[model samples]
Target chain A: MIAALRARNPIKPGKLRLGIGDDCAILRPNAGDELAITTDFSLENVHFRRDWHSPEAIGHRCLARGLSDLAAVGAKPMAAFLSLALPKELTARHRGKPAWVERFFDGLLALAAKMNVPLAGGDTAESPAHKGKAGLVAADIVLVGGVKRGRALLRSGAKPGDLLYVTGPGLGGAGAELLALERNPSRFTALKVAAPGHPHLYPEPRIAAGLRLRKRGLATAAIDLSDGLSTDLHHLCGESGLAAEIDATVVPIHPMAQLAEAAGWARSALQLALHGGEDYELLFTARPQTKIPRELDGVAIHAIGRMSKMRNGKPAVTLLEEGKAVSELRARGWEHFRGSSSD
Target chain B: MIAALRARNPIKPGKLRLGIGDDCAILRPNAGDELAITTDFSLENVHFRRDWHSPEAIGHRCLARGLSDLAAVGAKPMAAFLSLALPKELTARHRGKPAWVERFFDGLLALAAKMNVPLAGGDTAESPAHKGKAGLVAADIVLVGGVKRGRALLRSGAKPGDLLYVTGPGLGGAGAELLALERNPSRFTALKVAAPGHPHLYPEPRIAAGLRLRKRGLATAAIDLSDGLSTDLHHLCGESGLAAEIDATVVPIHPMAQLAEAAGWARSALQLALHGGEDYELLFTARPQTKIPRELDGVAIHAIGRMSKMRNGKPAVTLLEEGKAVSELRARGWEHFRGSSSD
Candidate 1:
């Protein structure tokens, strides 16, 4: 299997002193720089599924999952290593859909090509069990990206009273997922309430927004809104060692979210806006009243909340319902929300 | 989970610009020009037994496996990303072995601290099954390191007439496992191959030797002895697009192997040397007469083979039996060794 893999793809980069087919890949970075490296995993069923997700989706998703971490830290991806596990059922599935895995690679390569990311080294193994019930096919994607000397973003930069803002419209992503999985849906996909545009499958990660935010010297602290508003806001607040007050009424809701509500589907656009996961949007805290633009690369900035002090004595999020303050908004589903709770 | 994880880690780096919350980790490369990245996985039943592998071991083994990959690649380890799948068999086995897990972190951290590597960012998820037999826990470790660029080794650099060599002793690792698992092996632990060596418990990746080789410019091509000599040689040879020949007598045999043989065991040292996996020794190639060192850091480099063009239009490996060239090796066990071939 290693030999066959070796024959299939011989790494051909001048900078790649060594690549696939070895225990690890060897490379040279710029003349004087520290390498930015990170690893992430995509397990069957958890990150993906053989029954539902195609290998192509699996590959693309896994690759993106890893690269996104690099992006979150504002690093330019350079190299990657992958480790994959195969189950018995996958053999026939993989064989029958030769393109399944290949398409996944193609998806990954497309992004890699766009990003100039190179494949480094990886290992593959079959599950100890033949049945799918007992084993998991897994992959760990490692990325080596570069940051200019003296400038990598970290999580501890926010201070008291920093303005909490997100780079793109929020709340639409979770709403979009509802629309996609819905048994019936019409107005949600295009209506003003949903704007189910970029949320369902591929919400863009804010590589540029982060760069722009940094370049403008505005964002004091930043994090990606992988989790929804309520939770992610709590995170930036917690990291900053502060608290926050968010006006839940003004949250940018998805167009479809309103329609879904009419169907007795318990969804508040505000709730979706606050707690959905995998939105991949950029949520950052900047100096209050910093001269900000309407958009960066055409994505608007929405200020839903302002970071505050911990004077209330408890870390909390308050929602505005019919002009009244409510402690919580429970519109996002358990699965759609992100928290350190279950993970 | 993402929110809680973000809370725990806080993407806060004093020196880094883009830290825990961004898409990718963006950090300036230090005053060095090279970056090396590696990824590895620890699967239940394959790398660890569910019954024996505590969560701490699961955690420690995950990082160790990845760091070892960096070591094999000859990179100075830097940072890592860990993706963990926690099976529900949460043990008070030390309260989910949190301290053990922390010790696992300490093991990697202590080494990383010495090696200047750090625990960067990671994600955790509960395994699908809620019970021990229900599933296995897996962790993928991604390691980032630095190299001198262009000076990194390759498995495809060996030319015809180049010599084949392996770093460290082989098979004694598998031999150690036998003793470690045996009930009355207190006698074997005193032996050099067994004492202070828990091969199955801890597979040492030869980081120092790899770094030394990179610094000294010794090896032409390199691969770690992951799937035994027989399979790994095929990898080295196959990548260089050549064939190999080895002297069965020249191979080093572990001390425990000899003892096992003395005890009326049918297993030959040669078989273990050729087929045992996870020796983690470096199988490197160099030009013939290139001062094949007798020992590297106390481990001998056995001259096992030479690269060659196909003789008589056949890709084969010959062993000197009765001082006559007998073709005894084909690509017979590479696939089987890795379980990549259908039984």
Candidate 2:
């Protein structure tokens, strides 16, 4: 199996002195660069449902989760390591091919190639089952990225008056698509190619935008919107020891989210945009005087809020509603401990 | 939970620029050094049984697996990123404390401190359970280490006539202890502290010996004895495109293996030494004329084999028995796909 994976993903010899087949992969980083490392888990049911998601989507999302972290830190990806555990049935060869596993790699390696990252090395093992119960598939992806020394963006670097920005045209497409998937799993079974509409299955990581933000020194603080915007905004504010006020009227809502609201699949598009997780977009803060671009590398950038000082007896985040009403924006995001159902 | 883990394992801040509570951790590698990366999985039932292994031991073994890989490449430990998925019951508070998870970290952080590796960053999620079946605990540990550029030990660097050596007093102690564990698990429930005798539960990684070998330029090729002597030796020879001959009588058998043999726990100490896996010792090769020391630091080194040219249609590895009987040595290590039982 390791040989098959290596054969399919032939790494060019440059940064990687040694690839798979050894106990460890050796990486030679560029001079004067700091390495950014992150790991993420994509477990069965919790992260994806086998019946609702294709093998390719699961693999793509697994790698995307790690790459998004690197983007959050404003680092260029160098290599990715995946440790995968699968049940017996998934490894069995049918018609002389391990179709499911191969398809999973197809999704993963395709993204890796597109992002110019190599699948350096990792471990593979059989998932364990208890008694007559079936085993779940779990994948953990580790990404190693590089940035100029002392130039990586962090969640704690924002100031009280920094303006807030987010990448992409809008948000909550992933959550809306997930709602559609739950209503009809078969609607996405034939969706083999990764396109813009399938954000829930193929959310793209904002690597280019993050790089530009860091290289040009346009952002003060940044974080990937993996857990809803409200939750992640809270994290950024708490880390920076500040507060935030978001203009609800200016929040960019995805067209799909609007469609979901019109179809009665969601209570409101604004609510989904605020609390829908897995968008893989970059939410950042910049100095109020900085002339930030309207778009970066073809991805639209929207300014929707500003950081603020934390006041006694006040919420960390305040929502400025369209009618000038105010409300505390609690983090009703997709927390794993809150429930077992998928978000 | 992230804050608790960070507070418990405070990094002294040298190689690591940032620890937990970020999208990614930043690492500053020393000048003229390359990074070595490795990942390993510890799955419930497959790698450890909850009834037989303590939470601390499980965590120790999980980190030890990745550290041993770093040791194989003669890399100094830098940081460890762990992605853990736990069952609901394991995460729930017991008597106002999350004892199991805390003990797991206690075991892991204790070794990380001893080895000078920081718990830099990681991800945690709830392990998914199917239907009414209980969920399993799975951990994937990623270790990043630094080595001098162009000086890493590799499995493909061995040459014909190179002498084979292994670290520590003996082999098969882990395998032998596993046998005892299978027969009477309750006897080891109170064995909490890490010591030399418990090879299976608290097997030490030979990082010092590997570093010494690389610093002295004594080793030509290297690999960790993770999959047993016969299996790992086969890997070394296969990668080097060479064959090997072992002297059976000179093979170092652990005292625990001898005890297991006396207690009828294993067929023979030699058999256990030959094919039993998970020793976490370094198996390396040195030039025949190199003045390799008898011991590195406190770990003993023994030379019991020599690399040889591969003959057409001949076995990759040959075992010379006690009376000079030569026989083919096949890999009988613990393969995950072979069966559902433990080693």
Highest TM-score, which number?
2
Provide i-RMS per model in Å.
4.9, 3.9
lDDT of 2: 0.88
Worst 10 residues of 2 chain B by lDDT: B334-343
What global local distance difference test value does model 1 have?
A: 0.60
List TM-scores for all candidates, in order. 0.83, 0.97
**Candidate 1 lDDT, A189-293, residue by residue in tens:** 222121126354344556666667765677777766555566666665666677766677667676656655666565565555666566667777777868778
Q: Which CAPRI category fits model 1? A: acceptable
**Candidate 1, residues B221-329: lDDT per residue as tens digits?**
8877656677677777777888888877777766656665556552665666666666667878788767766776676677777888756676556555544666667
Looking at model 1 chain A, report the run of 10 residues with the lowest lDDT sum: A187-196
The alpha-carbon lDDT assigned to residue B183 of candidate 2 equals 85
Query: What is the Cα-based TM-score of model 2?
Result: 0.97
Query: What DockQ results for candidate 2?
Result: 0.57
| Cα lDDT computed for each candidate against the true fold | 0.60, 0.88
